[model samples]
Target: HAAFRAGLVVCPLSPLYKQNELSYALKKANVKALLLPGCESKQSSINDFHGVFQKSELDEIKKNLKHLILIDGNNSIPNFQGFEVHFFDKLLENDGNLSEEAKNSVTSDDPAALFFTSGTTGKPKGALISHYHMSNNMKFALAKGLSLNGPVSVPLPLFHAFAGIGASVYPIKHYRPIVLNNFWFNIKSTVESIVKYNCVEFWGVPTMVFNLCEYIEATNTKIDSLQKILMGGSPVYESLIKKVKRLIPSIKELSIAYGSTEFGSFVTQTGINDSEEIALKTVGQVADHVSLKIVDPITKKIVKIGEQGEIWVKGYCRMLGYYEDEEKTREVIDQSGWYNMGDLGVLDENGYLKIIGRTKEMIIRGGINLFPKEIEDVINTHPNVAEAYVCGVPSEKLGEEVCAW
Candidate 1:
């Protein structure tokens, strides 16, 4: 309702949580023309239009949106929505028709999507990302690196860059269907999805894999078909790798990935077909397309290998910077265009990065300088434990104390 009054249309690229919330919020705000991205489920109840954008109050409220598009990054959107579904061929490239001008100018560097810096502590920085970055990341992660031949699981929302490129665009580029049905996955469902689709890969947070490990052990189901699983969003526990090796013996590889919405997966754990050590001990080798450096934050000097320092990345895969905030972009991107990732690590003797800890995740506990991952790693090594999340908490005597949860 508000967007309508303000002459703005919101094309939401989100899951059910955002869809219903935005629907109610937009009505309260007098906004409209929301292109929601899911099928109605028990959680997100049905509107009469069969899970696609229904032409009703939801559609009537907005006045400015030229088009209402449904983007189920997971491909779970039902086919019965009254409106015609517009995919890459229909929208991005013009189905079966291309002008010579369009052909010549259509480069990967063309406008792809828009995102903003979290800007939690400062003004929001919106960045216009290019197809070149998104597509290349998607192509390599999916078809080449992950060896995905069929549908992939995408629980992450498309508003985030990883799902947008890795799950949605990359699979679509190859004319593959995303396994959109059966949205949420627990241990049972995850195993079922792998068996049902003969799914070779799954991409999600490490915690998710940890949960799945718990699930399968409890259920005692066979999940030998799944090939590689990418644990990217957060740090992976070494114990989880040991669990995967024990339970899913057919898994050809286990990749501990470290990436973010800004840059694609820059480091990969190859040669780690069975060794969980590579994942826990190092962050893997840099991608062919990425160049990395460890610099001393205080002296601004590039440190030697095997030395801990602030990590900087330079590559085509890197983002241009915060969209509209020059000052913030200047803070992260160096004068030479290399991005200071705000992370601290060392490239060890074998060229694998051991993340000492984030420059921020470290805490001065009684002046001892503590890192949670170390304690957590020890706890995770326990034969009975599954995973752990470590952080610092307030302490009157020590200034702060490491809390392992």
Candidate 2:
């Protein structure tokens, strides 16, 4: 909190490519400087642009951009064009040099963060989130609290909303956060981070958990500090839940939370603090102040509770409609302020939501999610696999399965 106030928003990334994108994205959002890694990948780009002096870079910026600050992670600094590059180790040392402007420049509604959404549509959507969104996201997530009482650990990326807001902002709200600049998209690294951080709450895809189950059994290493694990972005398995319960009694609860970038987080399974049924039964009832209704996708008719229908939600947290696309925004957000989630679910008699399926090309097979679009996307990377259309074929046992043809 104070560091942000002090004008040094730390980007502790070592991977040059990802952190470079973060630096550029921040600049695109009007951030004056960058703390880029000094490693081969990032440093080479900086030195290549000797003519591209930091001031010249700012002068050339079409947006209201200003300066460039690079923090060299690998301890090599050439002082290119008197650019603002600091050795990575300097952050750990205190020079008593806080700037005045860094504290004064930001406002509540100013664009503070930018991220790319793996949109179901062909193009990935560049999400421009403001200070308000970041603040509110932290407020929403901190409500979930840490699984372990002493501290919380997150393995998600700082660039992603889950890790950026959930892991970073929320912790800043109350504690000294330990942020790892590394990306945790794979199983092995993700487990290592969790165990190393002694993370109480590890948030990621179910496939991550599926893989962790394999890692745990293979290593026979107990993740003791990982007391409580929460699964989102995809579904968790009963078999997986059984594994968590068997392994970590301190897990207290393996809360299954349902949320999205569009709607901010609206629902969460009750923590160990709540009834045991909160964890076992279903994704806990649509969160407070959140209005949820199931509608027939074709007719748009509101279905009765316990009946399956498309889930539509209207709440304070919904995005201010998509940034500049009114027509696209209208497609989901209706005049009534309800947002069609493209999700199919049922409201139990008791009101807990049971997500059944998605309405769009998005596929959540059994518990494994496969957006044919995303997969076709990866397959298209292969020059031979020209065009692809992945669809879900009905599976009697597993709810639904993926079939790409």
Q: What do the candidate models score in CA lDDT, each in turn?
A: 0.61, 0.60
| Candidate 2: residue 158 Cα off by (Å) | 2.1
Candidate 2 ranges beyond 4 A from true positions: 1-35, 39-67, 74-110, 140-148, 176-198, 273-281, 299-301, 362-405
lDDT score of residue 274 within candidate 2: 49
Best by lDDT: 1
Q: Which 10-residue span in candidate 2 carries the lowest summed lDDT?
A: 46-55
- lDDT, candidate 2, 1-405, per-residue tens: 554455333332223234344444444445455544454435454242322332344433435433443544456554554345555466567775666776688776655444555557743344545566557665654365453444555555565566655665666665645535343355666667677666666666566666676788887867877656667776454556777666665665566777776666445445456454555446666655568889987899999878877889876556655544577778888999898887877788877777765667656677875556456546655756535667888889888888887
| Alpha-carbon lDDT of model 2 | 0.60
- Report how far off residue 332 is in candidate 2 (Å): 3.2
- Superposed on all Cα atoms, the candidates' RMSDs to the truth, in angstroms, are 7.2, 8.1
Best by TM-score: 1
How far is 161's C-alpha from truth in model 2 (Å)?
Answer: 1.4
As a TM-score, model 2 comes out at: 0.68
How many steric overlaps does candidate 1 have?
Answer: 13
**TM-score of every prediction relative to native:** 0.74, 0.68
